[model samples]
Target: MSLLLSPFDMAGTPLTNRVVMAPMTRARALDDIPDDHTVLYYRQRASAGLIISEGIPISREGCGYLFNPGLYSDEQALAWRRVTDEVHAKCGRIFAQLWHVGRMSHVSIQPGQAAPVSSVAVVAERSNAYAWVEPGKAGPVQASTPRALSIDEIQRISGDFVSAARRAMDAGFDGIELHGANGYLFEQFINGALNTRDDRYGGSIANRQRFLLDTLDALAATIGAEKVAVRISPFGRLFDMQPYGDEAETWISLAAALSARNLAYVHLSDQLTIGAEAIPQGFASQFRKAFRGTLMAAGGFNRTTAETALAEGELDLIAFGRPFIANPDLVERMRHDWPLAEGDRATFYGVNGAVTRGYTDYPAYQADASL
Candidate 1:
């Protein structure tokens, strides 16, 4: 029986515990450089067994939002080196989530005045497709339909991801996790509604999942599978509810292919959403049985729910997003059943100043907190 807050073995790396500091993009990396403030923000929460940074763009064309940290440039690499060094000094392991926004980006943000690219041209409901938002703004400027990527372009982007992985390793980080979910570039290729092509990269389940699979192959070859992980959202109408119609088959085949690699871990995005009900009882459990490697879950999981999932053999680790964002010492809080800090919706994203005022300023449990 694995506990949500106990030490566990993942990819042969032992951790202080199973509690992981889930990644949330705070848009804090202004000018693509992590300042002294960035160093303190991460060090404030360096106690998690594992910490994954917000999605870091892998190429210039891959920059989906402004202020989003990147790894493709020399300066960005230098900044990340500082972050990794701090986390390591505290004995904490961290992984960088390499990202590419693809069609989910604005023409103004991409290269050569080019529109955002995708496997198909299908658009989604209200989207967040522009470059990074300024300090205080709601709707982003409308993004144009991206030009479909050619095979040569795809190859180029693949190489970009490979290089980014190398940079992550060079930055003194423990590992890297491919952001293959949440309707991002790799995911756009996985979902059918957005991918209506007849090429080797689109159509059938295997074809739709081709880009991710190939990327995994390249990543495993470039960085040992033991140093690589992948994040996937199996449940949820996320990113415009485009799960390729036959999502189950897609996941089945996708998980099976990844299992073949025996990577570091496979973190599933199946936890409950704000308005969505609990997941059907045994679905994730079944998927865990299906996968032959380390498994984790994220998205709104409380201690009991997480324990149940882990107890049922559905997950080996759990990733808590919003909670960890508000409470840097979440593991300590959870252990003592301490109440959580109610995160301010207003300050969840956007310009955060030096104090990490909204970033790492969440107060720990106080003796008189319970009025």
Candidate 2:
């Protein structure tokens, strides 16, 4: 049997298979709260070995997009409990992808119309935030310039992440995955070229990575390290991230740092499918050598490629994103060599007057009678 179809233990969390459902944001949470639609959406894809949920903001200040369900408040936690309960009932393990969008945000979505905060005062040119273009209407707009975060504010934001982690545990999640990838808040700090601060949080390579490491350690202390996972995108040029002198050194050093922590896993996000440069060849193996832990990666992987990757020993687990959108029983289909269905791009983000049309309405694969 292929390793992709086999069961494995990720830290203390046991997964039924090596197939993970990658986090993808579907703007169905109209009120920034998970509702019945959210419950149904997750429940349909409960067959995945692990489901990393779409980014759930730690606080309103951390939000980059409209309609994303958050994990800051107790009220939001209660709403998430419903989704977790349904997924757990189907014997699936889930992790909330806690997020903070930093400069990739607009004042329209900011609290009190405040500017978004990041490691430095800069604007992510050519980036857009899904926010209100006008009153009562939400669409993609150019990201607003952000103010630099004060040291006190940085500490406060770390506290917010810890608070959200506690809420995720209380809501019955199997674990929490820090959304440190794709030029988000964590990446905004880690990228030395972008985070040119004069304080302890910038300058040296160690300083640039200090924010992420510190926050992860705090989360591990609050919850068990075995239940915490983090995702990173190395050489990721998304959201105006540019190449730096120590680009390679930065990521490899982080892999080593994470290795010592004994966390659940280290997930690598390859942005190839999303129209960005892929993680260069041989880098994954280099990372694997540095980080001696369960490793997972998501990009574009079909059944053949996924199986080959597992066979080659580069990735312990393979995460499928868009495939799971149209095929709820993705594991079953792959195992049986069944044909997969394609998803509609237009209906991928928001509900255009039809709430569940593209969200929960995708049907499972049906067998051909003449086959």
Candidate 3:
């Protein structure tokens, strides 16, 4: 059996193990630049086989949260360089997760308080975005409806991704991962219910996928194909995403298309949200057969299940999100079968320096910690 501790190679990079720290939104950056605190937070989790950084906005219009980082500015890229250097100092490999939130955003967080942009003019349900709480405070606010993007604007957004990829390379990241899931910008394009455009960006799967694929091709052309990866959620219904009858077929087609790119990997996020339906069994195996490259699966996976999947050749890597938030040495704990600590939910998305509370304060495994 291939234990979770087994070493693996992600494209050209050699991982110390198969454990990956999944990308998570930590509203810590100021003016979209990673501050000194953000560097310390990632440095604490550097023991992971791979660390996928939190979602980074590609441009001012792409931002959805008050303190989330962006890569368009030179100072922002330089700030991220500090984080990459710190993580590398511990011999850790990291990837930047490029993001655009689309309709799941509020005007308060958008550029000049403009309407959030997406494939269609739609409102997200059961969603919230981080916003300013007071003069200097930040908190969650209900998401606002978004305006549809023009064809020219969509092209501009796609081009912005290429620029972000270059900025990520300049920031000293090992690679970059495109965030295509969770009813964000890409899902707004991929999901038929949300993308009701009459032009080439909607109607058919190929058309709906054009925007994402174009961005992918552009980024891959700017940065090497092997250095790019993408994450997708096939059955996810978060942020008011409605499931299409042909959802599985749509994703299968995407997986097949991705196989031709020779990209680093494709991460599959399960529908694990509250009230969300579970994905059908055998979905991972089907995707693996079509993709023909490194495959990663996240959501509700533990050591025993991850080992079984690896042993059975179902997944090449396993990404843990919440576990890594509270356990910086999650790999070491999993290795020793140590009991994990529960994270404080209130501190998960805090602001005003409280972001550092639940972030870097988590202790590594100690012999005295009750198992």
**Which prediction has the highest lDDT against the true structure?**
2
> Which residue pairs does candidate 3 place in steric collision?
133-137
Off by over 4 Å in 2: 369-371
Q: Which of the predicted structures, 1 or 3, would earn the higher TM-score when compared with the native?
A: 3
TM-score of each: 0.92, 0.99, 0.95
Models sorted by TM-score, best on top: 2, 3, 1
Q: Of the pair 2 and 3, which is ahead by TM-score?
A: 2
The lDDT of model 1 is: 0.78
The TM-score of predicted model 3 comes to 0.95
Q: Encode model 2's per-residue lDDT on 1-371: one tens digit a residue.
A: 87899999999799999999999999889999999999999999998999999999999999989999999999999999999999999999999999999999999999999999998989998999999999999899999999999999998999999999999999999999999999999899999899999999998889999888899999999999998999999999999988899999999999999999999998999999998999989898999999999999999999889999999988999999999998988999988999999999999997788889888999988888898
Which is superior by lDDT, 1 or 2? Answer: 2
Question: For each candidate, what is the lDDT?
Answer: 0.78, 0.93, 0.88
**Which parts of model 3 have CA positions greater than 4 angstroms off?**
133-137, 273-275, 368-371
In the order shown, what is each candidate's alpha-carbon RMSD? 2.8, 0.8, 2.0
Model 3 global lDDT (CA atoms, 0 to 1): 0.88
Q: lDDT, candidate 2, residue 170?
A: 98
